[model samples]
Target: MNLPNILTLSRIVAIPVIIFLFLTGNPVAQWFAFALYVIAAITDFFDGALARRMNAVSPLGRMLDPIADKLLVGALLIAFAFAGSFTTGLTWAAIAIMMREIAVSGLREHLGSEGVTVHVTAIAKYKTMTQLIALGAMLVVPLVPGLELAAHGLVWLAAVLTVYTGVEYFMKAWPHLSGAKV
Candidate 1:
């Protein structure tokens, strides 16, 4: 495996440790989780850049990159939800985000099988950025003053972007989504 793929795999390896740290309920553990998360998030950017710069992109990296991202983001969201980080009535926002992720993933897989490619959109990249920022803040909410509010705002913003991107992806792939392949 190349450096980029190794970095991607490292992210996948770090998810459970991050979740463990968050679950421990200690401030130090939370900080550790936050650090791990930030490192992982940074790797997401570098792996892609390195892959392109070094001409080392592979089908395996393409498949595992998103899986690693989903694992990291999904674990953080579920942990935060369990910790009651979301608003009283806004838990559905998290659910909506998760549902959209799964739907889009499934849609992408279905299309891939049909010889159709679904590319990442600029909006979706923004959604990822907001999501990582939101989740990072949420993970470290106790460490910073007034950050919980900011974290919630980021989450809401990410949700809006997520929904919009989901719609955009659906519309773009609607032609392929139809027919017996769907």
Candidate 2:
């Protein structure tokens, strides 16, 4: 119920609007969607900082934050794929990033049952940054020439980092994943 949590919930609430804008098929809508996405991504950073500064962290916020992130990123990637924005290697790269997210989330949930928490790493944070930048570029690609290529490159980079971080998390959690109980 604090500001940070409010911001996090706002990100979740904005998802439907973002989706609507993306589906509108207008250049203006695409710009609006890109702005919304950038705002959401900024909140992802500020919310955590506010939570830490205000000491208002809650289990619900902890749970909701990552889910919101995943939902936003996944929805954008799927939307782009459906819209044919990913005509080249970007589609597979997006798929790879999405798969890593799913795998890591599942692994984290399983590990949580064993009282083991898998903290987000610096590399994971970097991957998220690249993904957001890539997604933002893709959203606005139509408005700018040659930006789509940059977006694709960013996505590919993010995909590689996503896979690397996914492997890192899995390896770190392997012992707990081996039928260990809390």
Candidate 3:
């Protein structure tokens, strides 16, 4: 009910609209989607900050924030893959990122159920930023013809970070998974 939670919810709401915009294959609609995405991403950052500042953090916010993030990123990645927006040979990068997301989410849930807490590492935060930047760059590729190389580069870079953080998270949970003492 607070502003922070509202912001988190807004991102989930924006996903379908954004995807529909991309599907239209209209430059203007895509640009609108890009704009909406930028706004949604900004809300991602602010929701947590505002929650802390206002002393209004709630379990609902906690549960929804990460879900919102995964949905937004996952949906955009899938949209780009299906739209063939990624450069040939670069679609694997998108697959890698999506795989990492799913793997890590499953890991977290498993650990949580086992009374183990796995925190978000600093590097993972950077991975998220890189992913958002790469996705944003990809959104502009059609409208900005010369951006293909840069967009593809960003996607590759994001994929590397995604895999790295994913491994780091997995290693952190290795002991628990192996039933060894933590």
| Best candidate (score: lDDT) | 3
lDDT of 3 by residue, 6-77 (tens): 999999999999999988999999999999999999998999999999999998999899889899989998
lDDT of 1 by residue, 49-106 (tens): 9999999999989999988888888888898878877776447778778888888899
lDDT of each: 0.88, 0.87, 0.91
lDDT assessment of candidate 1: 0.88
Candidate 2, 119-179: lDDT as tens digits:
9999899988888788888888878898877888888888899899999999888777675
Comparing candidate 1 with candidate 3, which one achieves the higher lDDT?
Answer: 3
Where does candidate 1 stray beyond 4 Å? 180-182
Reference-based lDDT, residue 124, model 2: 91
- Candidates sorted by TM-score, descending order? 3, 1, 2
In candidate 3, which residue ranges exceed 4 Å CA deviation?
none
TM, every model: 0.95, 0.94, 0.97
Note the residue pairs that clash in candidate 3.
none
Give lDDT: candidate 3, residue 167.
Answer: 96
Model 3 RMSD, rounded to 1 decimal: 1.0
Best by TM-score: 3
| Candidate 1 global TM-score | 0.95
